[model samples]
Structures are given as C-alpha cells and as structure tokens.
Target chain A: MVETDMNSQAKADRKAGETVLVADDIKRHYEIPQGAFGKPRILKAVDGASFTLQRGQTLAVVGESGCGKSTLARVVTMIEPASGGSLRIGKTDVVNASRSQLAALRSKVQIVFQNPYGSLNPRQKIGAALEEPLLVNTNLSKKQREAKARAMMAEVGLRPEHYDRYPHMFSGGQRQRIAIARALMLDPSILVLDEPTSALDVSIQAQVLNLLRDIQKRYNLAYLFISHDLSVVRYIADEVMVMYLGHPVEQGSRDAIFASPQHPYTKALLSATPVADPEGKRERIVLTGELPSPIAPPPGCTFHPRCPMAADICKRLVPPVQRVCGTTSWCHRPWEAETESAA
Target chain B: MSLLEFTNLSVEFETLNGGFRAVDNVSLTVDPGEVVAIVGESGSGKSVSMLAVMGLLPWTAKVTADRLTFQGRDMLSMRPKEKRKIIGKDISMIFQEPTTSLNPCFTVGYQIIETLKKHTDLSRAERKNRAIELLRLVGIPAPERRVTAFPHQLSGGMNQRVMIAMAIACDPKLLIADEPTTALDVTIQAQILELLIKIKEENDMGLVLITHDMGVVAETADRVIVQYAGQQVEQQDVKGLFRDPHHPYTAALLAALPERATGDQLPSIPGVVPGQFDRPAGCLFSPRCSFVFDRCHKEQPTQAGKELGCALCHTPLVAGKPQNEAA
Candidate 1:
C-alpha cells in the first residue's frame, strides 16, 4: 500500500469537482404512539437542517446525545428517507430518487456506524465482508472482487493474510479499520462516520485517526464526521455545525467556532469540554437543567432555559439567524460578546 | 494526618487458568479536603485498587497490604463489624453507572435514608428530611418531588445526582468516586464535578477520583497518580504532572490526547496495554515505551524519590527536556 504514492494530484482532482452533498432544509420526524388520550406526538429527530459538504473536506456535526446529528447522518446516507426538503449528491436528487436511482446512489454515499463489531457480520470473513459491497454494487466477477478486497485490506494497513480472519479475531481498532475499508471498497464519494473512534482507547484512537487522515488524502473523500468530542472535531473538521434539540444553532469554520463561538449553547459546549492539557485552564460555563425532550420542545429559542445570557426576549421570540464573525448563529444577541471582548 | 493511606497494596484474582494480579504494590495517600485522581487505561488496576480498599472484590480475588489505614485506624486488621461501620458511614463509594448502582424498585429518598439510618441515630421523619436536603445539596431541582422518584423516572445525570445524595447522606470523611461522570454528557459532567468539589470542600472530605480521562484529572484533581499494567508508575502534583511527567508512560498518555496534538499526525503509543498473560518479564511498559533500551528489557527500574513515584527506567526524561523527544 505504501508503494503507491499520490501527492497533490488526487487533492487537486477532488477540488475540481463541485459540492459532493447538498442538504437543503432536511427534516426527519417520527410519529410516536401516545396513550389513547390525545393527538400523537411528533419526535422531531432532524428538524429543518441544511448544509453543503465540499469535496476533499470534512464537515463535522456535533451535539450532545439526542441532538439529532445522527439522524441527519441517517437521512444523508439514505438509511432513512428525509421527511422534508431535498438531499442531492452531485447532480442526483437523492431525496425523491427512484429505486434504481437509490441503488446507484448507494455506491455514491456510504455510512460507517459507531460500533464496528455490531456493523459487521461475525460469521463472515473479512474478505467476504469487503467483497459483498462489490458484488452487490458492481458487476465484477468473484475473482476480481477477491483481488480487490485483498488490495483494499492492505490499503487499510492490514496484511492480506489476515483477510481470511473473522470479525471477532480482530481488535477494536482493527475492526474499525475493516469497517472503513468496507465503506471505501465501492469508492464512495461521500462517507458518513458516526462516532467511529469513541469505542477505542486513546493510543488506538490516535492510530485510527491518522489512518483516516491518510485514507482521506489518498481518496480525497468528502467526510461527514459526527462526534461529541470537540477536540477531535477541531483536529478533523474544516467546517463545523452545532446542533441542539434537532436545530442547527451555529455553523462556521473550525477556527471561527473554536476561537470565537457566538451561540450560548456553543460557548457552553466549548467551555464544558475539559482540555487535555493540565496547564491550560479556562473559565467554564456550566449549563443548568437537562435537554428538553424533542417530543415536546420549548417555544422560541430552545436553549433559553439553560442559556446563561438568556433574556426575556429570548423566551418569547425565536432568534433569527444572523451572520456574525464569520459564523451563522441563531441567537438573540449575536456578536455582542465578541465586540465587548474586543473593546 | 492523612484521612486514608495504603502502602504495598496488591490484589489478585484466581481465574480458571491461573492467578491474575489486578493491582501491584500501589502506595497512595489521601489527605483531608483534597482530590486525588488515579488515571489509567482499562485493566490498569486503577479501579481494582480502589475496589480492594472498599472491600468490594469478588470471592475469587485475594487482597494483601502491608499498611492500610483510615484516620489512624488499621483497616486491614479491623473486625467485620468495625469495617461495616466505616465502609458506608465514614467512607462512602459511588460508581460509574448510577442507574445500575441505585435500586430501581426503591425511591431515591428511601436509599438515602437507609444509609443515614445505618450510620446515624435519627427519627424516620428526620431521615426523610435529611434525604430531601441531601438531594438539594447535590443540585437536584425540586428535591421534595425528586426524592420520591424511582431511578427510571430521572435522566442519567439526575440519577447520578441521586447517587451522590445517597453517598453523602452520612457525611462521609472519604468518598471514593469511580468514574462518577463517565456516563453523563459534558455539561452534566461539569455540573457533577463542581458539585463533588463543593461538597468535598464544605465537609472537609478526602475524595479519591478514579478516572481514565486526563482532562477530568487536570480539571478536578489536586494530586495525580499514573498507573499502568496494574502498577503505580508515577505520582505527582497536578501541575507538576502536566508540566513534567516523570514516567515515559505518563508522558506518552498525555501526548496521545487529541487535544494536545500539535502536528498533522498524533504521537500514538505503538501498542495497547499488555494483558496479564502477555505482560513483559521486566518493566511492564517496556514493550510500548519508545525510550526502552537493552537494560529496560532485562531489569525493572524503581522510583528514585523518597516517596513512591517511580518511572521504573534507567534513562528517564529529565524535568526540562521535551516530553516527546523519543518520538
């Protein structure tokens, strides 16, 4: 795998293409069966979220648990159809695509789940698991698919001899590598990774992150990385979108979000995340109260209950989305904190 | 005097194959009103050592210690009843999964009151009032309503708060919290840690926080203990530990954090923590240590300081040198 080297050529080729995935006001909600009392409640899993992922770059979706980030990924990956809005891959409209079109779109966008062990069939060998995608997606013969699987295994830093091994035989990190290899087997233009390395140890986590970086560079694949870890997001994401209770509260570049977060929820999240450096100390903003249930969300600004600077206006009126300091933040008081800090 | 002290403490479990030593010669002390953190990866014996102290090990395990004392009282030699008096009263414990640790069938108030009843002489109504007060102390809103709620009725963070209320019911002198906030969200974790620190300070309690996250240790711990492969490799003040880690393992661990990453790639330790059967004959970390030499393979090194802070290496990193020089 190390024998073949492509420097800037693949990156330049990737940039030559247009946006890989464009999601415009996508929504995914579920109807829950309440006690035979009143109308059924609607669980707004992914409510009116929109973002565009460029080629050769990563767009990270971050939030606490139950924030609808994973649901957005599911919608993009076509695991579940979006209830509203449009999703496009290149020029293909995935939201309202037909059966054969979706079959083709499957090779364009793929997903890697959080638990690698659960994603892969324990009974299947690594070679067979990797080849299954090729068999279903392409018209390649069995021998050709086997050769490609061995090459893909080697490309992911695994030996060809280990291709015959079962899923249980590999470690957590190795299994994740296999999962990544399987996702890339069809050469998908877009990859949605959901908490890929959260299960591995720190040392092993580093290895997997580096491996992902190398694979990204080689393939120049557009990644929709979903994680709750800000530190990892800071390292991997070119752009970030902060979601809260099925709403995208803030979206900006990595530097903009990390250096100067405008939204109160974004600020709270950044401060609450403890820095690994012991010598590095910063004042933390601890949010009070639990996340409101998505089934029955609060009116107006959803974060007003736990927001530190929440005013009377915040509770009564929905904050309008405004561009502030290179970031689009939905807040009642936008960039006021930044101006004060500057003064 | 220290509130709790353990010297040369070791714990081993007898499996079907053979004996597996979970903890090895770990010496640590906790002074009153201080937060001492034990940091390590999985199977590093951080949890096992604390479990040994709490006498919560399974029947297959064997515990040994030259000195184990709490408030000048010998814990290892104490009678069964005496140990019981101190275990839940003066020295309480909290675990990672509060949902599992708490009894789901019983109300939160009942559990807190039971702890109070076992340790203090109070009327039933007084115990109930104290339970409500404890819930308020742990920052649970609407304590009166929450006190009667079952474990399933509350969220993960609220259940953890209830667990804390029960632990501090007896006003324990020492609280051993094992990964108390590991299962909660970051915001919730910050709240829980702040509550723990506030309670520890107000009551002058010594807290032993067992966690693997360096960020949590740096933020909450006054002193830090670094363990690897069931042995205590390094111990230092929080500032000192971050500024100049003595052991190669500690330095590597800090470097491995994604937040501390500098270049395009991270400096990962090459291998995972060795299992019991695959451990090296000499230094436990020699296989993964980048600074390992021929001597490190043949013999184990000991801590040079008067206290038990050993790197177990011949050519350990000096105070001023860069931590990732070997990398």
Candidate 2:
C-alpha cells in the first residue's frame, strides 16, 4: 500500500528543512473597461509585494479590504497569474511552470478559502469531496483512495463514519475541518489559508486555529495565512506583513512587528485594535479619511493622505525600505515612534 | 429619567417549527446621554431585542412586553401612527452594513434631505445646507463634493459616516447603532466609534449599541448587557463587567479572547449555543458552560437582585455587588 511509503516519506520530508516559497515583487494588476467608449483603467490589485515561506512556519499577510492581500494569495494559489516579478515554490518557477510541473505544483501547494460551505460542493458527500483531490492529483485506485480519505478524516479529528455524510449535516467549524482535510489530502507542502476562520464564531475560531497549529507541527507545512484579524495573526503568525493600499508597509518577525512597529501606519493599526481589557488604556490613534482607492492610489507613500505624521517629503518621494530592529519597515520617518508595550 | 426602558420584553417568531423565543424576559433601561451596549454572539438575541424595540421585526414576530417605554411614553400601547411619528424622528437607527442600509439609487445628500424632510419642516435651501452641514459634522472630507456622491462611490467608512449623518439628521434623541462598525476595517472602525462617541456626547442622546466584539464594548460602552440564548446573563457598568464578570459565560467569553489566553490552549466553550428547539429546560447556556451541574440542567434560575449585578445561574457567581447602582 502507498500508506506505508507515504508515512515514511512524510517523516523524511519533515526532517529535511528547506525554504518552501519565495515571492519577489509579485504584481497582479487588472484592466477594466470603463464604458462603451471610455479607456480601460488599470487597477493595481497587488503591486510589488514580496515574502518568503519556510517549512513549519506561517507568514501572515494582514491588510484591509483593498490592500491586495487576497490578490497575493490568489496569485500564490495559481488561481490567477501574476502580472510581473517572480514566484517560485521550491524549484518550480510559478509563472512559467510547464504542464507536468503545474500539476506537480498543484499537488505541492493547496489553498483553503474563507467560506468552507462555498468551497465544498453541496451535492458531494464528504468522502467524495476528500477523494476528488486524490483522483485529480494521483493515480491511486478506488480502494486505496477510499482508505486514504478515511485516514484523512480521522487525522482532521472527524469520525471515519462521517465520510458518507453531506457538508450541510455538519456545523461551520466541522465544515472548515473538512476543508483543511481536503487541502491536506495531497500532502501539500504549502497551504494558502485565506481567512479560514473569519466566518466561524470566536470559540470555533480558536478550535480551527488550534487545528491549524497542530497540522503545521505534524506535517511541517508552510502556511501563508491571510487575515484582517490582528489578534489571530499575533497568535499564529511567525512573520507578519502589513499591507496598505496594495503595498507592504512593514514585514518582520511577529515579535518585532507587534512589540516595536516602526511605520506610523503599523503603529496606528496596533493602536486602533481595541483590546479586550476594559481597564487597559492604550493611546488610540484614529486615522482620518478612508483607505484610498486602489484604482488611482496616491503617489509616493500610498498611505500619506491618511497618515497623521506625513511630511512634505512623504508626499513627494516614496519611502525607502529600511531594516530596523530586525524588521523591514517602509516609511519616511521610522524613528518618530518607539516600540509599544506588549499586551 | 430613562430614555428607553424594556421590562420583561420577550420576542418570539412563529415558524413551521413553532414559536422560537428570541428575547426572553430581558429587562434593561437606558437613560438620556448614556451609551448602553448589548454584547452577544449570533443567535444570542442582542440584535433581535433591539429590533423588537425599534418595531422593525417582521410581521411573523410576536412581541410582548410589560413596560416598553421611551421618554415616559408607552410604546406598546401607543397607536401605530403615534409610534411611527417617534420612530426615525426621535429614534433613528444605523445598521451594520452602511452600504445596504443606505439607498443606492439616491445620492447621500438626497437621502439626508429625505430624512430631514420626513422628520423636520426645513425649507429646500435650508435642508440642502443642513445635509451638507451633517456631512461636515461627521468629518467627511470635502462635504460639498461627497454630498452629491452615491453610496457605492464612497468607501465603507465614508458610507458609515454618511449613515451616521443621516441618522442624526432629525437631531434624534436616541440612536440605535446595531454593530455599526462591524463591516469596517480596524482603523476605520475606531474612527467610526470615536465619531459615534463624539456625536452621542455632543447631542446628549441615548445610544444603544449592539455588537459582538467585547473590545468595542470595553472601549465605547458606558454599561454592558451580556446576553445568552435570548436571556440576560449579566449586566453591569463597562468597567465592572470587565473587572469581575458574574456569569460563567461572560467569564469564558473574556477568557476565550486571543489576548487573554495565557496558555497555548484557549479556554473555549465546548458546545455551541443551542437552537430554540433544542434549548435545555434549565439554563440555556448549561450545554456549553464549564460549571454546569445537576440543578443547572433541571430548573432555570432567575437574576439575583434588581439593582446589583446578578447572574442567571442556580448558584449565582456574584463578584461582590457592583457599587454603582444603575439609574
């Protein structure tokens, strides 16, 4: 059976530590036709974003709605091709991977969407849903595939008896667990989790988080966790990337980013996040105005318009990326603020 | 004097599955110039209770209350016309999704003008000017330009501000914001909350905030009402609620927060909130509660005292009676 070989291979894979993914200045821009006679406008959904993912680690990309984090995730998951720059997963060049290589890439990299119910087919049984990935990616026979599906179900903490049940029979958290199980069916090295727990309740969210953490530890999988919830990021992310209007404002280890965020935007984000403690009084920095539209983003520092400490130079020239205290922060006045106290 | 008061208010919806009680004998009061936050998760009846108060629930819903009063006027006994007069004039509401709440066909300025026209007798030019003034008051940049823009043209935060502007167009005495900032970004949420606080203080209006986020409740609410399975679990001043929660559900909810988790495993409530059909005969939260015992599964327990904070548990988890008596 493939189970014995697969189990040993997984163990070996865990032992071999390696860089799983490297994304360099990846850009995903879309052109939309304005009207019948109007010129097409370019919407830079993701403009010049880069990050690295290592096995057994999670790199979280945190941003608001228009900040291009989701776009970046889509690009990584190969749902859409990047407009420019390079994306390499292990040895495969993501942009130009051949047909066979693309299939291999699909097996190596999988994605879990925000809504589990939407991701899974309504009519498909839980067993068939988990088996579909194996059938597409591998040449496993009927009996072998069924066994693998059952094993995967138990691995995700679902009963093997639940294999024949439909998705609607399960609760939201259970459905998400099935989604995670399906993603792990191919034994993918990288999992692009896009707001996996956002739709779930808080208690359920904690359960899913614990599950993901356990899965990462067991499989030595690299996770590209994309979420807008900072508290979740603080709990799960090894490294964090803060995005503003389709650009990276700050990226570093979770400790450095949370403890001592250099960019004013990062500081404001941290300050704006309401703490659960009612007695704790933290300086709440409320940024005025809304997130600038990605269609015609502000020149120079994209955050300059809403930035409180914006100077003349900030508007005129783009801020250079400077490494300070083990973090890469892009800002004009990085030294204006000090590190914040830990929660 | 209380601006809004609900005594033994219960709301039930008639479905094929029978009457599903959403708000069960929940009593609370909101005074003028006070911000009362109703905190609960989905299906906890926080929003439903507020909707019942607004008289906005569907026709299928059966609402019954002992004393549903607003500014000493009996809301339950009042004629439909009289109730309609006060609603959207003296009492206005801003929903969670600002985009959906505001009419997409009309411009924001037009909506504000419509609200002003319905409630107040302002002249054409005066209404237009007041609409622009309301936009400026909510801190929209270039109110002159934004007033003409449609809801879709504006960002989520801007639309929310526009909603706030429209909600206060009649200079409403009470504003019911149901998860007003839930749809916005954190920074944008902070701005909206600050704006709500500012407006509530300046206008001297009672604000009823319904939200699921304890952080927002902690930051903005003057008093907190914790709901569980359509019943009031605990009610206290915002500070006292956080300092020492009386109910296990409230304590567990606070503990479940990612920040409060001192260990790797968060103290999560094991089961989900039971549906109306499957609700246990005793305490509704007994299924998920950690300290559930025999009595918790047998008979429902009532609140301890009228003035002091109390929990709906057989053995009330009293965190020393809250000194501040709610007026």
Candidate 3:
C-alpha cells in the first residue's frame, strides 16, 4: 500500500510539473483619438480571450487579417503588454514580467515569424542566425553554440553545408527551416509559430509540416500557431480558436471543430477555405459585406452585419459563451449536436 | 486562325552574372473567347512568356521569336506607341496584389474613370455613367459611395473587384490576369474568378490566366499550358491535364496538391527547382524527372520536346519536343 501511494504521488508531481499555457481573460486595447484633441476611443483588440495550451499540444488562433489574432499572439508572447487579465505560463506571471524578467521568460517560449526573409537576416549566414539566441542567452562557449546550431539545422531537415550559405541562397521552404532552427536555439518549451509555412510551396509545405510534427514529438513543446490557412491548421493544431473582429468567437478540440463546428463564423471560415480537389463540393457559406472597422466595431455581436442567421437580439446583446455540442462559442445560435446528427 | 500565336519564342534577361534565359523557345495559341490557363510553380516562366507576347519586355530583355503575332500584327516589330495603344486599351492586365495595384492616393472610382478616359473618347458624364456600370457589373453594391473610398479604405476582396472594374473599364479584347486571385481568400477568390469568367463569356474576350493553382485551372480553364524552367512541358485540355498529366513536372504539380479526398499519404516531389546559373545542359526537368531517359540528359531540348509525346499531334515530331502521350 505504501509503495503504491509513493508511485501515485510521483505521477501527480510529474503531472503538476508539466506546463500548460493559460490565458485567463486576456484583454488588450489601443487608444485612438476620435478627433483633434478629442476623447480617446478605446479600441479593444482582444477582449477577454481565454484558452490553455497544454504540453505537446498546438492551439491555433485563426481569423482574418485585423481580427486581433496577431495581437493576441504578440501580447501572449510578451512582445506587447496586455491591458487586463493574467497570463500563467506554468504558474509564472508572464503579463507582469519586466524586460529582464521577460528575458528570463525567454527560456520558456520562442517565435517563428510569418515572412521567412523578413525574420531571417539577408546578409547573415544560416549558422550565425541559428547561433544568435544561444550566444545571447547562455554562457555556452563558441564551439558548443556552433555544434548546437548545426544539430538544430539537421533537426529542421536542413543540410550542414547550408550553415555557410545566406537566406537568399535558400528556397522559401529552406529559409523557413533556417528560421525554425534559429527558434529552437533557446531550447524553448513553447513556440509561437506565426504562419510558419504560409509562403512555402505545397510540396515544401508538407515537408516543413512533417518536420514540425517530428520536432514537437522530440521536444514535447507547446505551440501557439497562428494561421489563416485552414488545411494546415487542421493538420497541426490539437485545439482551434476562431477569432472575429476582436474576440474569440469559437474554440474547441481539432476533431470537434472539424467534424462539427458550432459557431456560424467558424462555419463560414471553413466554407471560405478552398478545398484542393477540383471535384470536391463544399457548401460555401458566402459571407457578404466587409469586416467592419476596428475603430467602430459593430455593437453586441461583431459578426451580425454579415452573419447568415443574425437576428434583432443578436445585434442588440452580446451572446454568452455557452456550450453547444461540447464546443464553446460566443454565438446566440450555435448548431446543436442533435441538429447536426439529423442533418 | 487563333487571335494570338507564339512561334519558337525565347526570352533572355541580361544579368551581371550572365544572360539568363527566363523563357525558352515555346509556342502557344489563344483563340477568341477561349480561357487558357498557364500553370506552373514559381520561376516556371509562365508569366514571362505572356509578358513577352504583350510587348511588355524591356530593352534589356532579348526576345528571340520567329513569330509573335497578335491579330495579324507582328508584336516583335511594333513601335513603342503602337504597343502602348494595345496594352491597356486592347489587352488589359490585372496583377496579383489589388491593394498595391490600385493607387492609394486616388479613389477607386476616379482611377477607373481615368482608365475609361485613356481608352475611349467619351464625355465626362458618359465616363462616370460607364464607370458606375462597370463597378455594378463586378458585383459592388452602392458603387457610387465605394468609388470615393481609397484603396486602403476598402477590403482586399473589394479592392480586387475594383481592379477588375478598372481592367475591364475599357473592354479590352484579351485580359491577362497574372495570379489575380492568389492573394485572396478561397471564397473571395472564387467570386473574383467566377466574375472574370462571366465577363469573358459575356464579352467573348480571350483570357490568358497565369497562376500556380491547379484547382483554379481545373475549374475554369478549357485548356492549359504546363511550364517548367522557362519551357512548355505539357499542353492539354483541362480534363486531360488533371486526369493524366504527361510531363514529369506537370505530374509533380498535380501530385503536390493536397486534396480533400480521404487519403493518408499526400504525394510530394522530392527535389527543388534548380537555380538559373545551375540549369542542367539537357532537359531542365531531367534532374528531377522520375522517368528521365537517355536523350533527356544528353540533348538540351526546347519546344519540340513537347511534340513527341503529344497524343493529339503524333510524330513526325520536332527535334526536342515531347507531347502529352501519357494515358
């Protein structure tokens, strides 16, 4: 009985040690003036977005260009300050961290940007770019850093000789690999990969995705992946968050979202994504009208202006985040599981 | 006879390193009201080949072609002003980025009105009337209000519709859409592509769509030209190309696509496109070709390479050409 108790305690402690990225009611806002010397308008970017990124899992934040997905990522990654809500990175208060404190916070997370060329220096060699993080953060010797850089390159499926070559010499996919290697330099437990393979070709996209999956398995790292590409998000993400205007309208497990999405915005987004097959028939939820300006976002429900099922109440009151078919959505009319099954 | 024809055309861009041939000796034809998709990966020379036909090639670009005729006019022999007359008025072109393509300083309505003024001899009132009509035709509601909005103010999809509104402002004979929907989301892309096709059918205008998307080609194109390393690898009907692509490069493109079909393994081509300086002596595709034979390596082949494999036009084929013989 004592032996069994001891084993259970060890398992519990180990489970406790495993970090889960929790964003509790995260909010960020920017002040924009209405007129010259007039009252400042509080432009809420992300208003109370809450989710958790468990260890060895990916949580995709998907939305249109100005939907505050990038802002959420930026605020969560400590690149920008959050206005309200607390960020617990394995019990560490990331939202309140100072520059040096954030620098120490760097040991936990890293980011791989969207533009492969923009993220990587044009003049710098791949090896040097990969070695930069190690040199900055650690007391590792020059030789040790070089060795780590080369190994990281191989981990990302780039050749060792590519170390000498610059970013310009490599293809879009190859350049992305270099960027991934650079991000891995800190041995970061969490990676906020922002549209990592968006610029790459289809075949190269597959290769890079496979590499990411392999690395995730090896390192057991958490990912806060941001992408507008649905197919890629479906492939890599364990849980998905759909953002609209400045709020997370829908979020659930990958299977739950794909097999049966509850939110109308999520449904519309899925419909918007062009399936590759020429013969494949997708019932398109054609969303008409432009995404309203962030400065003057629509009252109550942001998507009401273009939503197919918007009612009078939908435009008047903000819908509660109610559970529908096990998926949570800030929508008045989430598709019920029984209705989905019937359909 | 076809509206546009290319015979043994090759384009070379002179760089500091050397004269790099961006488009090899190629031949293609576009009939009146026909939609021809030129599909290939980046650096495949599909866009460059079309650019050559438009006489848009610069002074540094050495264009060697036996014949590049447009409606019986020798494009290669045309003067500067004569080409300019045909470029926007008779042959309008739409670029990928509608945001960047539309000038930010001016309103979309004014820009489109300017296009009408440049191409046609209409009064100020007549031009405004036509501009509003064009905007409406492209499915923009309340176009009068939208006309005043600058490119930055409009959404990406809306801006693209405005660009189409401008491109078709003068009712050109042939529309060159170079990846017009590449930057757009799927639903918006569908709308734009459908609108373009509808306009083409309505006006009976020839279309030259240059894109890397096979899905777009399969859905819209009647026929297609598969390009690789500045050369025509395969030319077939859309059905034929998608059903049974001939050239290895063409096959790779189709295979590279991830379909909605339930399949665990997605087809992927192993190697990357070779650099300009490092192009192989023989077939540009030979290094990556799965079924490369002896002749594919030894002889530097061009347009004629496509002729040999062509099922429609069997041999006696050209010296280097292989056509779509694959079943």
CAPRI quality band, candidate 3: acceptable
- Candidate number with greatest DockQ: 1
A53: Cα error in model 3, Å: 1.3
Give the C-alpha lDDT of model 1.
0.88
lDDT of 1 by residue, A273-300 (tens): 9886677758899999889899988888
Lowest-sum lDDT 10-residue window in model 1 chain A: A1-10
Ranking by DockQ: 1, 2, 3
TM-scores for chain B, in order?
Answer: 0.95, 0.95, 0.90
Model 3 lDDT tens row, B1-327: 677887889999999998999998778888889999987778888888887777777888988999888887888788978888888887888877898888889988899998888778999999998988988999888988887888998888898898898889888888989999888766577678879989999988999999877777877788888777777777878776666655666666666664532344445666677777778867777777766667667776434334233421221123224443351
- Candidate 2: misplaced stretches above 4 Å? A33-41, A159-162, A336-343, B306-308, B318-327
For all candidates, state DockQ relative to the true structure: 0.68, 0.60, 0.33
Local accuracy of candidate 1 as per-residue lDDT tens digits, B1-327? 999999999999999879999999999899999999999888899989998999999989999999999999999999989999999889989988998999989998888898988889999999999999989989988999988899999999999999898888888999999999988878999999999999999999999999988889989999998888888888888888888887888888889888888999988888678886687887888999887777678887766573324555556666634233352
lDDT digits (tens) for residues A174-283 of candidate 3:
88888888887786778899889778776677677777877787777788999988887887788999998889999998889888898888998887776545555667
Regions of model 3 farther than 4 Å from truth: A1-19, A97-101, A337-343, B72-74, B77-80, B105-107, B260-267, B292-295, B300-327
